[model samples]
Target chain A: MSTARANRMTPYLFLAPAGIVLAVALFYPICYMIYASFLDWNPSQRIGEADFIGLRNYTKLFSDAAFRESMWVTIKFSMVVVTIEMILGVGLALLLDRNIRGMSVLRTLFILPMMIAPIVVGLMWRYMYHPTVGIFNRTLTDWGFDPIPWLADGDWAFASVVIADVWQWTPFIFILSLAALQSLPASAIEASKIDGATGWQQIIYIKLPLMLPVLIVTLLLRLIDSFKVLEVILVMTNGGPGLSTEILSLRINRTASEFRELGEAAAMSNLLLIVLLILTFTMFIYNKAQDARMARLRKVEEEV
Target chain B: MSDKTYDRQNPAFYALLIALVVMAIGPIYLMLATSLKLNVDIMSDSSSLLFMPTLRNYETALCDFLWYEPEHLRRCDPTFGRALVNSLVIGLVSTAITLVIGTMAAYALVRFRFMGRDVVSLWTLMMRMVPPAVLLVPVFGIWTFQFGIDGSRGGIVLVYVALNLPFVIWILQSFIVQVPIQLEEAARMDGAGPFQVFFLVVLPLIKPGIAAASIFTFRVAWNEFLLANALADRNSRTVPVTIVNSLTEFDIDWGVIMATGMLLAIPPIIFTFVASRQIITGMTAGAVKG
Candidate 1:
């Protein structure tokens, strides 16, 4: 009887360690964060000592201009970076989807920018954007053009970060879309070609429509990641020139560490979590819908 | 459009490809070059490409590890070297812990139908989106106050394990699912216990998944700065935190700093070259499968 019962208990036994760790380190901390967001907390005091503010932190955030500006910056950064990366990445994928020599070598080279540490990426970009000794300004001056303040000016700093992010992340979209492209139905493509569909038509009508599901998922994944970006911006501009590049993540760090307002940082974190949860849920629902649609299509074809 | 067709591309396409390759790798090459250059050569506009390379910057960055003291150094700052050691230990330990538990969890989830795959996937995806910054405040409060694992390598390892568990579980599930159930049943028929079935049968087959997951976990633990900065005391600071701490100084040492950055980047670069296939597979598995 015990041996038979052990079989029933095996799954939970396998799951227990991961479950305990997640419950303690991840789930508990997140719950703690949510609770702490409601309290007036700080690093100087223990959580038990902090007063329960009951949504004062959230209300205060609504009126806080600096917080709102960072939110705006975060949104603007995500939208701009995601849009540009999607277009450039997908376009490059479509352009390069052909059978080419040295493709895997190119892919290896491409992923190097992403695999490196973001802090290191930030360091490289910061040196390259140095006002006087940077490569860009040096080359510009050598060519008789004016040296621009890449990370000094607010607008320029934002653009500079966007460029750096695009360079690092475009390969992600490229690789994903290329995978989707390569895995596509060869019979359908052969039929389309036999029907004399032009290259642009094939891409516009069939290829894109087929790749939309993967593209949407990629777009959402990138969007979620772009919001989490902090280190590179932290190392590059440090959200200087009056909060131009201060995304929500950076703002959260500053609030917690610099301002020492744990409560407010938790509130900011909660807000960011809500934003991400919405994105994740959207991806989940969209994926479910796509799966259902694919099932239905298969059912219909089988019926025919 | 057929898979076997050999399309003759124009020379312009090749030119564009070359340009893209250069754009992709130029900055990394620049960083490597800057790390090799002396401060004077790095600052000088003329002969930027013609300067002889030197190991002075590397020597300075890694002076703590070197047995013989270098002639150029007036003082040795052991912070970077210490942080490098801490990073490796924390990264390796955390990756090992994460993979061990994550593999079992994935095996259970895949082999035993306790819950729908979609539900677990959604959970993993949600957890994946939780930024380390969001965990900063609560993790600081909890680790410092409640769990009391704060300011130690164990504490940092705990957080890294937790941070990486969801993705590791998710990736390993896809890999474990591919392992045939008949093999497990055959092992069971040989009178092996459940643990033997898992460790002997399941674990060996999912090596690639573990490889991919370990690389990712190690990368995050090694590259992470925000939480590590908050949690690590001076003694346990990771390389990333030290790099960031140094950058806060006004007069940055471009050559030495780039050398530090290069050191931090070397492992991930090596992983990319060695396991680019697995890395790409791990990256696309979620989106393409979706």
Candidate 2:
């Protein structure tokens, strides 16, 4: 009788530990964040002591030009970084999706950037971007060209941050695109070849069409991740020379730590979360729609 | 044309490949070279290539762990070494705990039909969207005020486990879905209990998933800076926190900091080399789900 009961309870038993941990650690903190967003809180004050000032944090953020600039910067950074990385990554994927020797070695090397800590990645780039004793400036000097202000100026600082991110993340998209290309239906390409299709034409038509689903998914994932990028930019520019390079995450960090306004940071976090949630929902809907389209196509083909 | 034989490409193509390889690893190579060089050599305007490479910077970073006192070091700062230990402990312990419970939860989600599974799955998806910066405030508040676990390695571990759980469970779900339900049935028929079936049957089959999940979990715990910085006091600081702290100083020690950065980068690079296939599979499976 006890054994029967245990068997019935097994799944719940397996799940209970994770459930408890997630509730205490993950779920509760998020609920705390939502509540904290409404309160005039500080790091020095306990939650019980913090006054509840509903919606002021959100309204103030909208009025704050600095916050607005950071928001725009975040959006611009995500869009520009994702666009450049996608083009470069996917283009390279197409160019090198061949039975070449050392492909495995190349991939292993490519993943190194993505694998390493973002703080360390930022440090390396910061070192390279240093005006004196830095590799880039040193090289420029060696070539008898004036050393460019990589991180000292506003526009250059933003561009430097973007370059570092592109260097680190492009391989991620490349590897994924290559995987999608490899797993593509060989027969579709073979048929295209039999019709005397040029390499570019085959890629433009069948290959691109087949890889579209993965590409879309990859693009959305990268876009979502680009918003979360904090450390690399933090290390590279620290949002310096002005507010030009201050993305939302960096601004939130400053608000909470430097400014000592936990409520404002929480409000900023809430907005960022909402933006991410919208993007995530878009991906989910896209996936659902694609599923429906695939099902409909299968049904149509069956009737034919 | 043969599938088995490597495809031959143009000379120009090989040149392009070499250039791409060089470009991809260029910054990393620069880091490694800088780490091995002295400050004098690094600051030199003369040819950067030919220089006496020394491990003095590495020695400085790992001074606390050295068996004999390093003579070059006037005095040793124990921060980096302590942080290295903290990072390892937090990363490994959190990863182990996460994998155990996360894999079990994933197994239940895949193999058993239950009311709670939907809730669990929903939390996993939602949690992935929340960034670390977003958590910095609430987690700091909760840990410091509510739980009072701040300034301990355990606090950082808890956050990491929670932070990593969603991805781990999600990745493991796909792998668990592929596990043959028949194997569990056969084991059940042989009088293996539910716990035994999971541990003896299902878990072993999902080794690849475990490998991938563990790598990711450990990587996050190891590499994370923001929350760890906020939560950790001086005693519990991780390597990233230390690296960032050092960077904020007015006069930067390029060679030493680069050496520290190189040390922080070594484990992930090692993982990539050892299990590139698993890491790639995990990346695609977790993201593309196809």
Candidate 3:
């Protein structure tokens, strides 16, 4: 009886440290940020000392053109980056799904770009995009072509950042979808092949339908991560050429540090957090629905 | 499309594979090559590959840590060396703390059906998507004013531990689920207490999960800049923070900066090469599993 009683407390015991840390460091700070959003806070004033101007910071955000622009940039960046990465990544995964030699080596090499620090990634790209000494410009000059203003002009800066992100993240989608593809019920693919389905027909009809679930999850994950990308863009452009590449995260960082408006920054953060939370909640709901559907199908099959 | 085992592909396919590999590794190779070159060679409008490789850049970045003073060094900046130490300490300590607490929590969630278990799992799932950038403002405020631990390695470690716990717990849960419950029961039957059973039986089975969790936790801590930047004082700065700080100069030291970026990037790259399988397993744990 005593042993069982002691065992009853084990779960709490195991959970306490993580619970404490998350509460104090993660959960509390998030709450603090939400409260701070309503106040006219600054770097100098403590949270308690600041005047709580109920939702003024939030109201101010809507009128702020820069904030709107930056938010738009964030959305645009995520959509473009995810779409391009998905196309290239899934395409590469599909094309390279064969029983090839040195596949591990190929994967290991592909993981390099994703594995390296985003700061370093930005640096590599910045060097390559450098006008005088960068490899791209050098090659362009060698071929007697005009050098593009990679990070100088606004439009080009956005494209440059997108290219860097694609280089870094395409392999991630490739690897994930590759795992999904390889794990795909071989019997199903074999049946499709035996049914005289051509490559295109097999991919369009059978393989894609099966891969949709994993692809949606991958897309959502990538979309959420693209919002988190700041350091790479920071190192590359520093949101230069007049806020052209200033995504929401970078804007928040700038607002707090450069502008010294902590409350407004917190409000921006709260908005970004809400967007992410919605995405996460969607993913959670989707996963639950997927499981429930699978169970229902299994039950029906059992009855049959 | 047939499942002809290890079927030979056309030469163009192999060529495409080679091209992809080159494209993937190209920028990394350029960074490495730049880190090894002098500023003069880097700036020179000449053949890029003809320059003599040197460790001058690395020497400059790691000057304070070297046994002997580099003769070529004029003023040794202790910033990179100091930040390197801070990064390593923060990365390792945070990884250790996050892994221990995270694994225990994961084990409990997996083995025991307790109240609020669903809440905890959902919380973990949500927190995994919380970006460090999103945490920047409040973490800075609380650390500085409320917590009073700002500008210290401890503060940085605290945030990192908090940031990584959710994902670590989530990943380890999947791993711990695969552990045979019968083994734990046997251990318990041998008069082993719950703690003993967890430590002796369950812990050993989840080595791959631990490896994956540690790599990811350490990577975030080491590579993190925005929070670390806001929290760290001059002396407590990590490599990423220092590298970003160095980028604001009008005349940038391309060689040394590249070398510093390379240093900051080395651990994750090494982890990738060493444990690619575990890393992949960790990354695809959720989306692919779903």
Give the Å error, residue A291, model 1: 1.1
Q: What is the interface RMSD of each candidate, in Å?
A: 0.8, 1.0, 0.8
Per-residue lDDT over B1-290 for candidate 3, one digit per residue giving the tens place of the 0 to 100 score? 35446879999999999999999999998999999999999999889988899999999999998999889988998999999999999999999999999999999998896756557667898998888877889999999988899999999999999999999999999999999999988888889999999998999889999999999999888888899999999889999888888889888899999899888778898999999999899889988887
Model 2 misplaced regions, further than 4 Å: A300-304, B1-3, B115-122
Residue B269 alpha-carbon offset, candidate 3, angstroms = 1.0
Candidate 1 ranges beyond 4 A from true positions? B1-6
**Per-residue lDDT for A1-304 in model 3, tens only?**
9988989899999989999999999999899889989999899988889998998999999999999999999999999999999999999999999898788889999999988888899899998999889999999998999998999999999999999999999999999999999888999999988989999998889888999899999999999899999989999999987889999999999999999999999999999999999998888889889989989999999999
Q: What would the TM-score be for candidate 1 when compared with the true structure?
A: 0.98
Which lDDT values do the candidates have, in the order given? 0.94, 0.91, 0.92
Chain A of model 2 scored by TM-score? 0.97
DockQ of all predictions against the true structure, Cα-based: 0.85, 0.79, 0.86
User: In what order do the candidates fall by lDDT, top score first?
Assistant: 1, 3, 2
Which RMSD values do the candidates have, in order? 1.4, 1.5, 1.5
CA displacement after TM-score superposition, residue A261 of candidate 3 (Å): 0.4
Highest lDDT against the true fold, candidate: 1
**In model 3, where do residues sit more than 4 Å from their true spots?**
B1-5, B116-118
